[model samples]
Structure formats: C-alpha cells, structure tokens
Target: MNEREKGGVPDDALIRMTLAGDDGAFGELVERYKGRAFAVAVGIVGDGDDALDVVQDSFIKAYYKLKEFRFGSNFYTWFYRLLVNQAIDRWRKSARSAEVPFDESWLAEDSSPPDGFAYPRTPENLARDRELGDALQRAVDALPEYHRAVIVLREVDGMAYDEIAKVLGCSVGTVMSRLHYARGKLRETLKSHREG
Candidate 1:
C-alpha cells in the first residue's frame, strides 16, 4: 500500500494497526519515534544508560497498553506522559528522593559539558552551547516536578498547552502558571549566559 492508502498512516494509525496484528506497523512506529522518545528519556533521567533502559521499557509499556490508548488524541502527548511516569518511577526506585539531578550524584561530577554541541559546531561555540545546555539543564532539573514537566513538554516536546494539560491531567491555567514560573526561574538561573 502507498503511504496514503495506509490509512492516515500517522504514528497513531500505525499503533492501531499494530494492535490489529500488524507487528511490522508497530516496528515502524518504534523506528519513527525511538529517537525522540530516547531524547526525552535522557532529558528526564539525566543518564545515558538509565535513559536507554527507560526507552526500552517505555516501548514495552506502550505496546502492551496499546488498547488502553484513546483514539483521536495526540499520540506523542500521551506517550510523553507515559515516559514521564516511567522516568519518575525509575527515579524513585533508585534515589528515593525527589531532588533533581544537580543536587544528586548524576550531575555533580560533570562540571564540563558534553563532548560536542556548540552547534555552530565549531569548538568554541559548541563548547558554549554545551555549557549553556548543561547549566540550563541544571536549572531545569531544579524546577518543581510539575513545573519541570510543563517546561519540558512545552519547550522540548513542542507540545501545545492543551496537549500538555491533557498529558499532565491539569488545567491549561495550571500549565500556564507552572510554565510561567518555570521560565522565570530558568531565566534567573541562566541570566549570566544570556547575550546582551
């Protein structure tokens, strides 16, 4: 079948197909979204190894619970919520604390940024982006769980407020409020890095 003939052929549609005995369709969905899902996982758990485990578990959970997923809703928003809960569970299992990564051992040692990302991709600029990303991540990690969730959903996931509200099981007002505070705190924390 051509792309259009494959129904709407969206990720959700593929998932529905998977539920209907098309394992290949499920594999397609995994190939399509695994990178994004992994990025979200890493962003949350702050460790490459742990994030990989989360991503694997997330795929398993999504597959088994495919029947439970509501139709006509944003697939990614739903998936993101599942990821957040999974990451939180993993965190609780390991740390038994709600504190973000900076205050924890995960981030304490890596005073330097990642290997590369100055995304001018020049050595200096890449180093700067990594520095900023690292510092920004620390501040982001410090947000209250709800606020952090909103900011990540909105900014990183590019989810609309309504979608985020749906994922978060909160009102748009609550999403906006948490987002406002989250942004304000992030700005305050990263002020030194901002350009004039």
Candidate 2:
C-alpha cells in the first residue's frame, strides 16, 4: 500500500514519525523521493553511479540533521538543498580526480525532445538528434557551477524559480539571472554546432 493510504500521513508527519524513532517512516520517504533525488544528482554530476552515491550520502546527512530541520518547512525543499550540495561536492571531487569527456553514447536513454516536440524517426533525423544531444551535454558540462545548478534544477528537474532559489539558497532574481546566462551559453554553443 502507498504510504499516504497506509496511514494518511503527510511528509511533515512522516518526518515527525522518523524523528520519533520510526525508521519505516523514513524508509517511506526514501522510497518516495529516491528517483527524483537521483535525477537531480545525475543532472548535476553527470554520472549515474556517482549520483546514486550522492543521494545515499545526502539521505544519511539529512537523517543526522533531522533534529535541526524546522518543523513546518517543506521537507523536500530542505532535503533538496542537502541533495544538491552533496552532488556538487561529489562533482568537485571527481573534477579534481579526472576530467572525463562528455560522450553521447553514455547518456541515459530517457532524454526527452527539447520543448516536448518530437522529431521524426528517420535515420538522418536520429543521427542529427544524437549530435544535438552530445552538443547539449558538452555545453551544460562547460557551464560554471552556479549556472549549471540553475539549468539542471530548472530545465532538467523542472523546478520553479523560487524552488530552485530555495534549493540554491539564493534569491529568485539570482536564479533567473543564472538561468538566463546558462541558456544563452547553451544556445551559443549549440549554434556553433549547427553552423559547422
């Protein structure tokens, strides 16, 4: 049974239950958010295995800090900030260890078409799509950390600006500015690919 139907408990209630020593409540929360958390982490870190590690580490850190969480705050938002920070830390460490080049063949297969528009499945179109995807990934990887975070949270994770600001601990205006800059950089990068 779904956790909601199991006891009709909201996330805050679940957090309280977890804090009260109910590990099952926390497990339910983990089951609910793991995929989304992974998505956010993978978008930031660009590697599935590393992203998975980030999510696990983030959850462990969140568990330890649960007492410090303000009771009325949105649990996901608080948890998201932790997740993003942990993923960024993982990214920084990996960046120092090795600089792996972006490879389109290595990207996960679930990427959607830009703006929800579908491209034709002709062989030529498929090849072009692969090229575009590679170009996009390379461009995203080249972005600065703040800009990259804004792009991943907004475009990759479909987070609202205020929500991204909350995750990043920045003003909504900063989120907007960063997103704009990131998108502009992406367009410029892709445009070169198109011309060449």
Best by TM-score: 2
lDDT of 1 by residue, 100-187 (tens): 2332232343555468833233557555656777788878767776777778778877779898788788899999999999999999
Which pairs clash in the backbone of model 1? 118-125, 118-126
Off by over 4 Å in 2: 1-8, 96-118
Q: Give the TM-score of candidate 1.
A: 0.75
lDDT of each: 0.74, 0.84
RMSD of each: 7.1, 3.6
Off by over 4 Å in 1: 4-8, 96-126, 192-196
TM-score of each: 0.75, 0.85
lDDT of 2 by residue, 6-64 (tens): 76688898898899999888988898889889878877787778888999999999999
